[model samples]
Target: MAQRLGALDLLILLPDPELGILRPAPGFRQTLPGGSTWTELLGRCAGGGEFRATIAYPDVQRLSPADVFITPDGAVLMLIGGQPRVRASELAGAAGLVLALLRSEAREDAASASARASGDVTRRATALASSLDRARADLAKNAAALRDALSDAARLNDELRLLNETLEQRVRNEIAERAKAEDALRQAQKMEAIGRLTGGVAHDFNNLLSPIIGSLDMLVRRGVGGEREQRLVDGALQSAERAKILVQRLLAFARRQPLQPGAVDLNQLVRDMAQLIASTMGATVEVRVELPDDLPPVTADANQLEMALLNLAVNARDAMPGGGMLKISAEPEQVIPGKSHRLRAGRYVRLSVSDTGVGMDEATLSRAIEPFFSTKGVGSGTGLGLSMVHGLALQQNGDLAITSREGAGTTVDLWLPVSGAPAGANDGPGNAAEPLRGSGTALLVDDEDLVRMCTAQMLMELGYRVEEANSAEAALRLLDAGLCPDLLVTDHIMPRMSGAQLARLLTSRIQDLPVLIVSGYAEADGVPAGIPRLCKPFRQAELAASIAALMPTTAIRRRKDVRQ
Candidate 1:
């Protein structure tokens, strides 16, 4: 049975290796000299030789049968692929006709020679001429048959050429279609990433705002409800403090958070986080700290590093919902250039948090550090935890790497660059004090009206007569008019002129006047060096400390009316 495989109407054989020998061939076969190769043998056999054989399937270990037949003009037909399009009977008939023409030509040649040699007079001449006439007529009939055969071959050739062109076009169309699909997939991925970022941001902010709003709303109702009212105010303060942390994390991810980069003891940091991890992760999850005190110190923000550790701990807790061991360790490492995108070539403190839990697969692990991507269900977690840690590592000239195996465990490595200097004591949260008061006027600038009003009120509580400006240019106008204040406090991000640009301009003109830039995050390089900065959503006490640090020239004026 003929399989009739391949789009080709006819295939000419030329022996070659498979995989490498998957070459295109023209339909016409050319006779090669007698050889052992299948193609050569097929040609010889088809040249009216009595032979038949099976051969190897081009370099592959299989046998394919080949049938051969010779054409009148000494061409071979290899039906190796068994294509049923060309019929053996019809071709054989054409071959027979061609054979007859050859025979007639030979006979005519012999007759001409004999007639020339004989001295025949009138009778021989008449008989020879009649025979010549009959032969000429027969030659003409064969010539017409040959012409029809040539026309058929030409038509077949045109069809094969059109098929080849169509096949090439289809291949090009397939490539184009695949490219379009890939582009679409990339775009969809980008949009999904954006959505995750926005969702997580909103979630973190809303959670922080909920408690603060609830507490303040209760405190503001009617009169002071005594102790209950105090508790409400306390709750509001706690919520606001938490909100500040969330804002700092957001700033860190943006690479705008200012870090007080100094030598930090990795061993001590891990030790401190152990108890927190144990308590927070519950009894089912065990906590372990493996840190060598001899490990070198890494340059980073102490508070931010602590925050990062806490985040990793929380992440471990979420992973091990069924209980597992969480290990925190620190060691020295030397990174190569381009080894880690965040850290360059340098000695670093490798701080790691590993957990024995059901770990992440490749797909989930890849997007683990992406903002708002979390395996935990909504309301269970904000996906920003690992992302914030990643951001902190980057801001501190460090890199964050994750290793995980499904159903085995996960490990997050924080490679922080080592500093030669010894670690210093970090600031502690002390008892809250009254807002520092000042006699001189102060200038406050912000783009938002409500924020400006609130900040001005805080300054007023601090006993400074506050002036307001909606923008940086407007703030400069106040100065141009000779309305000099003790200090300048402005927003970091703004339209037209940013706080950093405004600060540079003010410093040149005001000479000694102090400036404070307040925002969620300021670009690490953009803000001027050595100017004191206070983060946004701050308390009156924080505002006082910042103002006192910057504007020492403003004479102290204690407000007796301030509540304890």
Candidate 2:
């Protein structure tokens, strides 16, 4: 039983009246303290039935009197040392077995009983050892299985963590794409609104500039002053011309300017500009023009395209403060449907200007085509170069694309629609013709008194008798009152009646009457087709050119020769 319980020693005790203390059964020895009696030990564990106590035994090497089990009928079973092998609830069954052994030993004579007890103990110890070995093997197997389960759980946890991270990254990317799309929509809306506002402002500004330019032009052309005075007048005229160009740029940005789209030899244009670009960019910049021999012609405004190229070249020159290469190249591209959002699906010629210079970052590139948005210092730039080029491209049914990265370089692509017609289809009467000298009545109409006055002077200078009206209604009234003019020149935008409305009315009443419509900006819906249009802020020569073209013959006469 001691071997089964894993205890160092076991004892069965009974009270002895002669000793007045508890004594072990015959053939057994007491292992408790010398002074300890059964009465004292029982007193320490009083009031608890079938109880176990941890009694200290200093004289012995054992750390604990492991279990002191009191059996029924005044018999005690005790275990010394080691933890109790059986639970408190199972201690009763162990006590019963111990009590049976004690009873069996007590039934025989002392020597014979001792010999029988020794044999029984040896047999029980052997069986208990075998049971202990089997229990150890089962415990080891269960421990290994638990370790495997823990390892699998850890691996699964790691895989689940990786999946969660991937999902989070994808969500972040989706959010970023949504934000980028929203930003693009907002920018487009802003540009549209700005275009409308600038168009109107440019119209009014051009109206104001016309009289100033016309008067200055008259002064400079007539040579009406001394050399010093002539120089001052020429300077004033130059300044007015500068303002006119500025207004043109504003009109371009608004997409309200008229464009003369013609089949242009893109390769030839670049080659012709090569020397000019080189000179303009200084010797520090090396200019290179790379164009394929068989590059197709593109449809675009030749003059505006030239300006766009020049602006890009100048910008490239400014970017390379130290020096760099400027390359102008052209290539054919075929855009497929649904492949691009900015450009229409068609054949196109891509005119690109590349520069090995300091480039713009994302923030700067986003605003690069916005009017008046410049990176240069104040007063150094008007900030309309890229915007004008962009607007011109749009007006020609084309598109502009810019690619740049900080510290790398920049490339600007102007995509023009491919033209079926050969180049120079609209190059107009080759050389500058002599100014038209007319001798007839010119019915000049305008709402602004100063603009009317300026036009009247320009007409008089061109040797034409002028009849002025404050509005289109007045011009119609003049025609209704039996006044037949040789020609009609009128501003497009007027109160009550537009220039186009007047021209239509007059054309219906009087056939073959030469008409010229002048305006600050192109109002395609308001203007009548087939009538010659001369843009406002024109000099006398420009006015003469329009008249000469509208009535190619020097002598022009009306069907009815009545005068006011």
Candidate with best TM-score: 2
Clashes of each: 0, 0
lDDT of 2: 0.80
The C-alpha TM-scores of every prediction are 0.62, 0.70
Candidate 1 clashing pairs? none
* Predicted model with the maximum lDDT: 2
248-299 in candidate 2: lDDT tens per residue? 9989989988777899999899989899999999989999999999999999
Q: After superposing candidate 2, which stretches have Cα over 4 Å from the reference? A: 1-174, 431-436, 561-564
